[model samples]
Target: MELGLEVAEGPAPYTVLAVKGEVDVYTAPRLREKLVELVSQGKHQIIVDLEGVDFLDSTGLGVLVGGLKRLRSNDGDLSLVCTQSRILKVFEITGLTKVFSIYDSVDGATAS
Candidate 1:
C-alpha cells in the first residue's frame, strides 16, 4: 500500500506531519522527502503523528532518525505520536524509544 502524508501547521511554530499506511523500503523515501522538504522550509520543530501507520521497518526508523538529526542540527526537534503496540514494539526493540520523544496523542506531542 502507498503511504499517505499530510502536512499541517500546529501550535505556534511547530509543523505536524501526519502519516498513514505502511512505511517500508518502498515508501520510506517519501517520508524522507517530506521531512527534508520541511527542514528545508526552515520548519525545525516537527511532530510526526504516526497513529495511522500499520507497519514500520528499519528503513522507516532510519528515516525518523535522520529527520531528528536534521532538525536537531538546526536547533529544532522532532516529536512522535504513536499508540500502536506493534509499532511501538519496533521502537522498543531498536532502543529508539530512548532516542525520540514519543507521545500517545498528537495533543500531548504538540503540548511538549
Candidate 2:
C-alpha cells in the first residue's frame, strides 16, 4: 500500500492527505477515522490527494462522503485531488464528483 499523508500550511488552514494503494472495505474505515480525528482537532479544510491510490470501492467513497458531511457540520469542507480516471469515475458514477470539490493536483487543491 502506498497510502501516506503529508500535512502542511496552506493559504487557508488545510491538510493534504495523500492516499495510496487500494481503498477498500477494510481500509476505508481507517482512513475515515484519520480524517475525522483531524476534523476533531480543528483541521477543517482538507485535500485528499489520491494520485497514489490505484483503486477505490464504494465503501471508500462512503467514507469520504461521511467525512465531508462530518466536516461540513462543523463549517468545514473536503476537497479531492485525483488524477486517476478510474477513481474519478467512481465519484462520477456515484454522483459524488458533484458532491465534493475536485481538483487535478495537490497544488491546485491547496491553492484554490
Candidate 3:
C-alpha cells in the first residue's frame, strides 16, 4: 500500500506528522515534501509518529535524517514516536537511535 501522511498542530512549537504504510524509495519523497513544507512554514519542532508505519527502508531513513538536519539547522528539533519493535530495530541497527529523540507515545514526544 501507499504511504499515508497526516499533519496536525500540537502544542506550541510542535507539529505532529502521523505516518502509516510502507515508506520506501518511492514514498520517501512524499515524506520529504511534508517535512520540507513544515520547515518552510516555520513549524520546526516536529514529532513524527511512526507507530502506524509497517515498513521502513533506507530511503525512508534518509528522509528522516534530512528532516532532522533541516530542523536542527533552524535551531529546532525533530522527535519520533515509534513503539513497533520492527521499526525501532531499524533505527537501532542503523545507529540512528542516538540521533533521534524517540518516544513511546505521541504525548511523551510532545511533552518533551
Give lDDT per model, in order.
0.95, 0.85, 0.95
Alpha carbon lDDT at 23, candidate 3: 98
Per-residue CA lDDT of candidate 3, range 1-112, in tens?
8899999999887899999999999999999999999999999799999999999999999999999999999999999999899999999999999999999998999877
The Cα RMSD of model 1 versus the native structure comes to: 0.6
1-112: candidate 2 lDDT, tens digit per residue: 6455556656668887878788988788788888988898899998888888888998989899999999899998999998788888998888887899999987888777
**Model 1: residues >4 Å from true position, as ranges?**
none
Q: After superposition, how far is residue 53 of candidate 3 from its true place, in Å?
A: 0.1
For candidate 3, what is the total of clashing residue pairs?
Answer: 0
Better structure of 2 and 3 per TM-score? 3
Query: What would the per-residue lDDT of candidate 1 be over residues 15-65, giving only the tens digit for each residue?
Result: 999999999999999999999999999999999999999999999999999
RMSD of each: 0.6, 1.5, 0.6
Q: Worst lDDT window (10 residues) for model 1?
A: 103-112
Q: Supply candidate 1's per-residue lDDT for 35.
A: 100
Candidate 1 vs 2: which has more TM-score: 1
